[model samples]
Target: MQPVDLNPKRKKENPLVWIFEPLERDPEYSRERFFNFQAAYLDGLLYLAVASGEEPWNGLVVCTSHDRQAGLLEAFPVLAPHPVLGKWLYVSQRDPEFETVAHQMVKLARERDPRMGVVPGKRKRSPDVIEMKSSSRKKKSW
Candidate 1:
C-alpha cells in the first residue's frame, strides 16, 4: 500500500502512467499491488485495479459489488466481469473511451460515490481468550 508516482524519467516503461498520474494527484489516493496485479484505493476503499495481463482482464478493474453493477454497466458500456476479481468489473484498455472513463472514475471516487467502494471491516475487536481445562484420562491410558 504505497503511494506511487509516475516517474518522468521512466514514463516510457509504463504505458498506464498517464492514467495513473492524474489519480496520484489526490492526497487520499494510493496504488499498491493486490494479489498478482495492482490496485488503486481511495480513502482506504479500493476503487480500481490495473491488470496488464491477457485480454478481458487486461485493463482497469472497477471495484464494484453487485448492488451498483447495473448503473456502472450503463455508464461504461465496455465494462465486463473481471476474470480474477469476480466481484469487480473490467474496463478494457482497448476501448476508445478508456482515458476519459478512467479519469471520470477517479473523479467519482473523489466525490465519494456510494456505488464505488466497499467499506473495509474494522480490525479492532477484543482479543480472543483461550481456556485450558484439565481432563482426567490417566486411568484409561494403555
Candidate 2:
C-alpha cells in the first residue's frame, strides 16, 4: 500500500485508500472450523477499546463477518507493543472499513513521528481445525 500523505488536504482526498495493501493479503493462516472463533476473539477486543475510549493508535483489532448474510463487524484494542513503533496496535482480517481505520492510524502514527511508517510484520495464522475426541463408552456405564 502507498504511504498515506499526512497533509490534511491530501489525506482528505482519499482518507481510507492507503490501507488496501495490507488488507488484501491472505491472512497469516486459516482454518475452516475456527473462523468464527477467530473473528469473535478479535471483535471482543476491539469492542473493549472502543468502549474504553482508548486512542485508536494504541492499536486496534477489527473482525469481519464470515457469513455473507450476517454482515456483522467488530473492532478492539491490541495491547501488545509494536516491535519498532513501540506502540500498541490493532490487528485484524481484511474488511470494508479497514482502509478507514488504517488511514486514521497512519495519521496518528505521523503525529507521533513523521518518519514512522507502517511497521511491517508477519501475520499470525489461525488454526485450521480443532479436534474433539468423543469420550469412550464403558460397558458397565451403559
Candidate 3:
C-alpha cells in the first residue's frame, strides 16, 4: 500500500454556494451540510442544494415533488432530471446557463414555492424521534 498522508488538508469552499446565497435574504432561511452539498431551507422546508463533485453529483439539485417538477421544468428549460434521482431536477455545473437557473431556483425557494423542498429522510414514527424531529424541524439525517 502507498503511504497515506493523514494530515487534514484545509478544504476549499464549495464553488456552487454562490447560487443559493441569495436565499439568505429570507429571515427563515437556514442551511445544514448534507453530504457533499449544502441543503437550504426556508422556515423548515429544504429547498435548494449546491453540489460539487464528479459528473451527476457536481451540479445543483432541485429537490421537489414529481407533481411540481413538470412546472419547474417549463419555467426553467435548462434544467433536466437528475440521472440518479429522476424525481428531481438538476443543472450541471458545466451548463452555460447553470448560474442563471440556479438563481431562479433560489428565487422560487425564497418565494416559498411549493415545488421546492422534500422531506429529508424517513418520517418520524417513534415518539422520541418524533419529538426530536419536530424540535429541529429537520426530518432526519440521510
Cα lDDT of model 1 by residue, 1-142, tens digit: 9967767664223355456676787898887766545777788898877766678656777888987888988877877667766778877888888878888877777787887877544545333321212233335656
Checking candidate 1 for backbone clashes, the offending pairs are: none
Better of 1 and 2 by lDDT: 1
The residue-by-residue lDDT of candidate 3 on 1-142, one tens digit each, is 9976676795667887877678777788888787678888777777878788999999899998788888889888889888988887999989999877887888788788887788787443789877877889866678
* lDDT by residue for model 2 (26-115), tens: 343121112112121111121112111224332333221123112111222222332332333343323355446655543433233322
Question: Sort by lDDT, best first: what order?
Answer: 3, 1, 2
**By TM-score: ranked, best first:** 3, 1, 2
Compute the lDDT of residue 25 as modeled in candidate 1: 74
Task: State the lDDT at 32 in candidate 3.
Answer: 78
* lDDT (C-alpha, whole model) for all candidates: 0.72, 0.29, 0.82
lDDT of 1 at 51: 67
| Highest lDDT model number | 3
TM-score of each: 0.66, 0.21, 0.76
* Winner of 1 and 3 under lDDT: 3
Clashes of 2: 9
Q: By summed lDDT, which 10 consecutive residues of candidate 3 come out lowest?
A: 116-125
